[model samples]
Target chain A: MSGIYSERHTLEKTESASETANEPVKKGDTAEVKESVAVNKMRTEFAALAVNEAFARAAAAAFFSRLDPTVEELTEIKTAVSEAVSNAVIHGYQGGSADKTVVMECEYENSGIIKIAVSDCGVGIKDVEEARRPLFTTGDAEERSGMGFTVMESFMDRVAVESEEGKGTRVTLIKSLDISYYGV
Target chain B: MKTEFEITDNILIAKLSGEIDHHEAADIRSDIDGTYAAFKKKHIIMDFSGVSFVDSSGIGVIMGRYKKTAENGGITAICGCSEYLRSILYMAGIFTIVKEAKNKEDAVKLVKRLEAAESGEIFQEEKEAE
Candidate 1:
């Protein structure tokens, strides 16, 4: 699992949140915003293992922490990531194939918006709309509650899903940081 | 994930600690459900104060147990959840069937009432069965 993260540690820090450049720098001025946009992308090819469900969540949570989200917001993101990854592992790969990979990408804007995407190379959903409905699970064989998409939609600001049958699925989730938490 | 269980009378209280995700929920659901059956408990109280993190799968675990216990004429209550968890529970429609308590003691009292009601003591027939 650690191998997935180390594969791509492309950290691009963009100074998008600061107006320090607009301020005239006096001789004694030492104050600056000192913040930047953090972009990170990682991919993992595990055996559709159940333990990787937590791994996915942990990885996403760690990535989102760069934005300094509140505990509540962090929990919400973690839950959303867990649902997407769980769907990939259980429904996508059907619990393990010889060569399967789940790719996750996250971008944190200095303006406090976080975007996350989890993609898998496995059997994709036939109908994305029906899947998003509450309690609309296709994995009845595993006692799945069918609440994965519902949970993701509920926790994140927006959720988008794209899939092709016999191809794969990709889910995107977005959440803006609560302004009160950042005082921005 | 770590689970601690304490039984008094017919109520089984389970305290879940650590992060709860799909993986953890899978094991926790089995463990708690198994313990609930093994103890022959009439009600269940889940304490989430020790739990630091939870996702939708955690919601699934609690919902599954609530249904299982309810089917057997038992009650399930939750206590010690963070404010955010309470919000999630409400939005997920979990609050419709399962009630919330401020703490374990309060949950026990709530379950006592529910158990009494289930046994027909709160309504009538306290003496019919006795």
Candidate 2:
């Protein structure tokens, strides 16, 4: 879980607002498209680990590539986002190789929302509610702060954890880029 | 990440530097435990002199080290904590068992005295030979 999202807010308190209905993948052009910077990035799945650095780098490249994020807010978003990715890898995989891949998708929805989906097809969670509890640990040897979700919630505007006991887990996060909290 | 170990008068000093979060805890635990197992020291001093920022994951690492020391009948002391990092340490209750020192010499002195008390020998000929 290691990326930076300074101008974003976490949505931990809200339930799953996942519409599940996939709108047609709209490719926006600068002249015709209402939204200026088109939102699209491709990330390869390799086990479960913090992919925020990759995502952040991509986002920074696509959106704020020319502008740099300040050190403090950069650290905040990087740490929290990385932690969220780490949680998906550790808890979602249950430390098994069988849980082969963790899928990550990053897209910009207009100028207001940046949506991220980190999904894993491993042993899904038994309790989504309890898992979000701070200081919770199910790892025998893995040292976790258990505040990954908390930090994610604190940092992002929307955090939705989708999991089924036998299936896997997917965390969808949305954040706003309108605020000046993030460096240009 | 650098880990150094040395035994002086039955006290093992494990110096750890750099950022150690959840990702590195497992391997560090194994290395420290393996070193202590070989030496069987009565006291352990973990010098946190060069650490910058430590998060809650660091708390787990400290707790694991504390457990290891207690189980081996040795006390764990953490020294060289800066004023800036004291809050994180305090929040994690690391001060409860992990003792701090002004410097390395002071920590070594404390460990020597503890060792002397434990073995009940201020100067033993055989212990001094090896």
Candidate 3:
């Protein structure tokens, strides 16, 4: 699990932007955003237990509710979070050891963009490409659909995977809401 | 999650309620499989009306049950899926193998019709039309 600590350190380095919570951060004149935007971030670590799956979804929903996302968008995000967390529990931790934990981080900007990352310290994925394929599960055939990555990819705009064979895996998902279309 | 089972005309109707995730999948599976084994029913109808949420694990549960029923020379039908659930199931290609019914009654009717067809018995609808 030392790898998990290292991963956390790296995340902290990149998350400096969230240090000024609720404060408007100035963005460079980029096509995505030209105005200063309020940014919020949340992070949680929980035991790699299957029961925590529902908890994780609720946490994400509650945190992102400030955006006033549409019902459809909310459900889509929750489903993607569930898939990522489930992968951390079932595959990353290899059936979930009590000592192991899954870490989740969510960062949202008023610009209608959200980034979520779920990480676990366990046996990491060897073939990221194959794992992303629909119905390519290495788990029990009868109990696993091997559609975790597929579902996440379908629900979110982007899905990124990082892993080491013996260390762990981290999955990051990002989605941008069309707030103007929804009039939110 | 909680599941209620009703046996009618040798068909098992399972009404599942609550969140369907990996944590609750084992219990659901045992409940359905146990009752299925006891009744020796050939067809199953999974009613998802009470279900609030589902992930990939739910897909596994459905696929596993579908395989079991098919192996026993039976079929599986699902009814009362929310639109969100339907999309997820469709993405997983579950609908290609498992029939979707508008409601529990429709599912029961479908299974009965299929059963009769398999046995070379004329369904009442066809008989009446004749």
Candidate 4:
């Protein structure tokens, strides 16, 4: 089961903004404030498998570790990640289709904010709004509780879904951190 | 996730350990539901002390068992959940029907109480006769 999803992920891109604070201030002159900005981004692909749900959550938690999120925050992120990945694996692929891949993207900013996007190039949702409703699931009632989107909305600061019928679906989740909690 | 089940006095005690996600939900659900059916237990007590994480799929597993047990005039109780896990379960509106406990012993007592209440046996026969 574990072999269905690949662990190899690339650190696709990295961007850093650095400013030197070497400017001498003169009397009656305004001094420029030097600011540094760091952006971290990563993208990974996984097979549409039920077992990879754990792998997605673990990967997201590790990516957000640099922000030093609290236990609650960490769990929230993990839950959201799990939901998104599960949706991709179960609904998007509509079975254990190993040929398709679910992609996960993680972005971190120095501004104490993290944005994650889970996308699948599989059968897209026909009605995203209806699907987002609580207790709205297309899967078997005996198997699904239909609270995936509800859980994601509750755990994340912001949630959005973009999908096209027959193309695929993309779920974007953003969370703002209280840097003070982690003393970051 | 791994689940261990013990039956005593018609109560099914399920001790779940490890992380519960979509990957583990199916197996765990089958195991719990299968055991609960085979034994005809009157109540279920889920111990979450060993659980470190749970996702929405986990809720499906929990709700399925609760619904099945409720259908048979049985009650479901969960115990030993961390604050994080409790909050997640709470947000999912599981508390509307399910009960929570601090420990395994309290959970057993809760299930017993619920069972009695379900059977209208909480009040003594003399009280009811009066």
Candidate 5:
């Protein structure tokens, strides 16, 4: 079943989130007593366009949170990816081609960092510098947010976007997991 | 991924199991539209009981579906929302478009009443009196 709707996600291995490491096992301790909490993880893809952006972001957020990302950390990752995926949809698929689909892969890194990679196969970005600029879009009718890359920079610790005009675009973002908020 | 939809009385409930993201949205949209079309139910309730994480993209799915339901003169409600999900929903203004209930039972009741009013099963004057 989809993890999107429930928090009681079952897993293969069990280890509690560091947050649970603090409290003593007092008699009245009624906190979630599960021996270990597993990081929730999800991986999926979407066809390029406005339609798929939201779903991609939501699923990625859920999956990444399992690594114990802070609220701020997660938000930054979401914004960066949202722009990249949106670009893929608007710039890649919207160009009117038969093959459509943007690939997304996310991994939780060992140092509590979440790594997200988004790649597309449609028309590539010819001028990487211009595309990265705030409020710059090749499209006319669909009022571009132009702030796509800007939002990404604001939210993520690292964002590397590589593109070629005729090829495709790949954007990667990484952020460290902040466990202190959870008192881990 | 497996998705389930059912109608109990006048309420339409959809349970989405699996990850909900862009890649899965079209299928989800099709599933939801097909379910609503088949039941012809007036009130729509989505059980987020199984959803673990959601982003703006997921918000688009809910908003898009809500528009479709609203076009049919029906209302949409949500239930079993996690606090994490609720924060995103609130920021996206989902509460402005549809009502949310505490659980599936509460949702069914709310939608049924809306259906009753639409179908004239509940006397308008009597409903006002109560």
Candidate 6:
């Protein structure tokens, strides 16, 4: 647990620094102050179990609710998160070893942009391009639709994947909430 | 997820509720398959009025069932999907293989009509009426 926390702390520092650098310097503007204060992030790790898929989705939805996204937007985010977490549990861990952990991190900017990353240190994908193809899956044909990556790509504004064959896989999903719907 | 089954004129109507993700899809697949086989139904109608959320796993379940029924010369129809779910299904090309109905009744009627046409019963009925 300490190791995970330390890793998360390092990630948080790096993200915050980049965010600060990208932020425009606007003096005496309340909106700018509010925007800077709105940046928030969360990270959690759980066992790579099938049931955790639901947990992961709910957690993401709850965290993002501060943005006051519309029902459709929230549903899309939840579905995309579910796909990423499911891929981690089913494919990353190769049948969901309870001992393995899947880490999920979410960060939101005041500008209505949200980014989510799901990672697993399991048998990494050998061919990411092939894996991203629609209807391409190495799992049981009867049980997998092979549309996880496709769903994520369609539902989110951007989807990125990084993996090392023997190390792990990390999927990052980004979406921008409707500006009118942003509460925070 | 929860599924309730009803048989009408030999068509299996499965009423599905709750979120359909990988965690629940396994149970749903088994439930639908078990009921379909046990009842020896020739066609199936999946009612999704109560389904709140679905991911690719839901698509897989539908595809798997469609393949099973199609191999046996039967058909599959889905009804009661919310707008989001319908879009997902359409994106997955599920509508190419599975029929979409307005509701459970429409699905049953559609399957019955198709079955009648397949068995030439509609022609017989027309001739008898004439």
* DockQ category of candidate 4: medium
Candidate 2 fnat reads 0.22
Weakest 10 consecutive residues of candidate 2 chain A by summed lDDT = A5-14
lDDT of 6 by residue, B1-130 (tens): 6799998767889999999999999999999999999999888899999998999999999999999899889999999998899888878799999999999877877787788888887633222210
The DockQ score of candidate 1 comes to: 0.37
**Best DockQ among the predictions, by candidate number:** 6
Query: What would the per-residue lDDT of candidate 3 be over residues A7-121, giving only the tens digit for each residue?
Result: 2212342333233433433456534543323367899999999889999999999999888899988898989999999998888888887788999998775557777889888
Q: In model 2, what lDDT does residue A154 have?
A: 60
Per-residue accuracy of model 5 over A1-184 as CA lDDT, tens digit each: 1221112222211113223334443333324552222232445676556656666777787887666676766766776677678777867666423357788877653335556778887788878788777556675412232555655665666666767677887776655567532213
Collision pairs in model 3: none
lDDT of 3 by residue, B43-108 (tens): 899999999898888899999999999999999999999999998998889999999998998888
Clashing pairs in 6: none
DockQ ranking, best first: 6, 3, 4, 1, 2, 5
Question: For each candidate, what's the DockQ?
Answer: 0.37, 0.24, 0.75, 0.62, 0.06, 0.76
Model 6 vs. true fold: TM: 0.87
Candidate 1, B5-29: lDDT as tens digits? 9986778999999988767887888
Give the least accurate 10-residue stretch of model 3 chain A, judged by summed lDDT: A1-10
TM-scores of all candidate predictions against the true structure: 0.78, 0.63, 0.88, 0.83, 0.54, 0.87
Model 2 residue A154 CA deviation in Å: 5.7
Model 5 misplacement above 4 A: A1-121, A124-176, A179-184, B113-130
The number of clashing residue pairs in model 2 is 12
**lDDT tens readout by residue for model 4, A15-97:** 11112122332323222431212257778898889888888889999988888898888989999999999899889998657
Q: Each candidate's chain B TM-score?
A: 0.89, 0.80, 0.92, 0.88, 0.83, 0.91
Question: Candidate 1 lDDT, tens digit per residue, A1-184?
Answer: 1221112222222122233423332333222642333334444445566677777778888877766788878888888988898888888988655467777777765446677778788899998888888778765423456777877888888786778898898887777786432322
In angstroms, give how far residue A21 of model 6 lies from its true place: 8.1
